[model samples]
Target: MFKNEELEINLGPQHPSTHGVLRVKLRLDGETIVKCTPIVGYLHRGVEKICENKTFFQGQVWTDRMDYVAAVSNNLGWAESVEKLFGIHVPRRAHYVRTMMTELNRISSHLLWLGTHALDIGAMTVFLYAFREREQILDCFESFCGARLTTTAFRIGGLREDIPPGFIKQVQAFQDRFLDCIDEYETLLTENRIWKRRTIGIAPINADECIAFGVTGPVLRAAGVKYDVRKAFPYAAYAEMNFEIPTRTEADTYARYLVRLEEFRQSHHIIQQCIDGLPEGNVMAKIPKVLKSEVNEIYHPIEAPKGELGYYLVGEKGGQNPYRFHVRGPSFVNLQALPQMTEGRLLADVIAAIGTLDVVLGEVDR
Candidate 1:
């Protein structure tokens, strides 16, 4: 249906709005976009190759660097993959700790997304306020893992250790204060006529188009596809917890925005369950002191802050390291639909559409 004559223009590699090093070549007809082809690889860090060179647990640090915004999820994913490969079962407390950390990271990620996405569409102040909340989340991560951004807290079988005394109390306190900040954020935009006008019905992508284009996570769910790896494929103890996988049929910027907002609430709910259901078990499972990579194959998939993050590992029996390792970065897949989603939408809506998609450079380019 996008039949406008092509007029190409470069859209980002350095632009702050893209939230990454993606260079999208936009084909526009006047002020309306006809097509968009996203060019990538600027931030390529060879994380997959790096994973192959390291031992199972050693490779986890690389995961932390991939999706920097949600290091906990990335760490959890790689660890889970190695665990699957070696048949290393995790403990109950370890599962709870992983869930708590990952959910906190999820909130941190969405906070950054909301801020940056809003800023891309002209709401500058939202960025600052969102970070204000993000700092608290980061504090929680730092308290537990010691590093706020690049945390290698999760190990092959489980966590490096147990959560420190008072950590749960601090997370609970942060959660208590966090709801008010969410309210503040919603009050700023949810009902604002300008926000709604700029977002609603702009850049609509239908459910089939989303699936066809390989969209996942909130973007796919925003199109009313309730396919979360967490619920459908229960890795960790997510099946034990209760939360909704927010979906919206509008499939536009506004719909995606609402979907993310609802997801934040759901993540909060999951965190509460994790805290309430904290069980007693060893944080780190007993395994071989060091892995002698016999991993012919390893597949670890987790509900990442962005979407589904799957780590693929391959190794020969008795090998010192993996033969190959690859990350199915959700940002890479989710972004494939950008061209289809932006078709016939205004030039301004392209940024809003991308913002709603919630991509990170480390994940997208890695």
Candidate 2:
């Protein structure tokens, strides 16, 4: 009689496909995954603890490093949370500009995901094509904030200044061609037989599983949950902007790809709205240089490119720094769904699962 044995192995603490220093311990029965456990904390920087020691005005910089790919989104979350804690009202123009920059960041973050996810699935041309548009968005980031990756773009109450000269024109130039760029990405992969074969029924988790696991972002949306913080909780200028929450019922790798691609179009639409309907007003609000807080706690949530990125803060009376701080990073929470997606599937599908989750380990380990 032949005996079937299970073999266990580590997928990565160093493998490029794991995305960022993530290690998945997998038990395999032949080529199929029997069990999967993701081990994190490799890149821990004590971000929450460190932010508690920094004053509100000084702590926004650390947010830039948490989700380095979507630093502007992180900045928005941090700024809004602190603003909530202090009850500061940001200017209308600042809200509009912040909305535009954040949507651009959404496109940039998604582009990085599309390129790297495609590369993980063996599509090399799509990687290059995705990064081509991503570079232009990064250029926009640099032109606005003077940094591309760790852009601490927003202040506590508002912006430090208005959009730089010709910024509208720069964004419009990208807007004019971005829809076609999304179509270009679709042309290469949407109908490709290999892409459909690799992604179409692989690594599926239905809406119930996603909700039970607290999954959000494209992963949850792919499962047909239309719960976007932008639409549900509405922050920044998102409440005023027009956009759609893209969802798919498949809850598989290919479905997630289609949803994110549609999101690209929605984000492009939001940016155009901001450019056209941007309000004329002061960018910064009248807040004291030194802000002292009352004993208060606030939790603020935003729809980051990944999912619901939330910041929870506690303030002490007359304190310069937060008494306690916690981050509900989408990557960390969404990563919980990995085993649900990967177990009972082929080991090769694990790569597609991780890629589709779109986790940035910086936030996971922060």
Candidate 3:
């Protein structure tokens, strides 16, 4: 008689596929994952604690580092939170510009995800093709804010400055050509035999389970939940924007891929609307040099590219800094579902599972 034995292994704190300093302790039985535990905090910078020491205005820069891929979205969330806490209303032009920037950020973030996730699943060609379009978006970012990645693009009351001359034309150029690029990516993977074989039924979960686990973003939406922070709790001109919340009932890796892909198109639509209906007004509201808050506490949540990125601020009567500052990073919450998805699956499927979650370890660990 032959005996089956269980083996324990560590996936990474150094493995590239783990998507940053994330280590997974896996109990395996003949290549099947029997149990999984995710180990994090290798990249922790005490971001929340650090915010408490910095003034409210200064803390805006730190939000960029949390989800470094979509820094504009982080800027929007934090700026809006500060504005809310101070009871300052942003001007109409600032609202439209912020919305446009955030939607562009969403497309960029999703492009990165699609490229890397496809690469993880063994589609190298898609990776190269995706970055080509991504570069155009980055070019727009650089021209607008002079910074590409960690752009501190938003001010508390509004934007730092108005869009430069020809900025609208550049965005329009990208908009006109972007859909064909999405179609190219889809042709590569959407119906490819290998992609479907690898992802179609992998890591499937129901809507209830996702909600129970506090998962958000494409992961939750793929489970057939129509919950989108932009739609449900509109902010930064989202209430005025017309877009669809893409969802799928399959709740598998393939479904997540589709949901994110659809999001790219929707983001493009919102950006077009912003460009067409952009209001003419002051970009920056008149705000005091020294910002103080009297609100006891406030929590503002926004639909970031990854998920619901929220800032919880505890304000002091006269202090320039928040007494208590915390962030609800979607990557961190969505990552908790990894073990549930990976357990009982083959070791190779772990890569696909993590890729589909679209988690950034910078956000996860912070």
Q: TM-scores for all candidates? A: 0.96, 0.99, 0.99
**Global CA lDDT computed for model 1:** 0.85
lDDT (Cα, 0-100) at 161 in candidate 3: 90
TM-score of 3: 0.99
Q: Give the higher-lDDT candidate: 2 or 3.
A: 2
lDDT of 3 by residue, 195-303 (tens): 9999999998789999999999999999999999999999989899999999999999999999999999999999999999999988998999998778589999999
lDDT of 1 by residue, 108-214 (tens): 99999999889888888889999998998888888887988998878777877689888999999987887788888899999989899999998788989888877
Candidate 1 vs candidate 3: the TM-score winner is 3
Model 2 earns a TM-score of: 0.99
Model 1 TM-score, 2 decimals: 0.96
**Weakest lDDT window of 10 consecutive positions for candidate 1:** 292-301
Query: Per-prediction RMSD in angstroms?
Result: 2.7, 1.0, 1.0
- Candidate 2 structure quality by residue, lDDT tens digits, 75-163: 99999999999999999999999999999999999999999999999999999998999999999999998999999999988997788
> How many clashes show up per model?
0, 0, 0
Residue 113 in candidate 1 has what lDDT?
Answer: 94
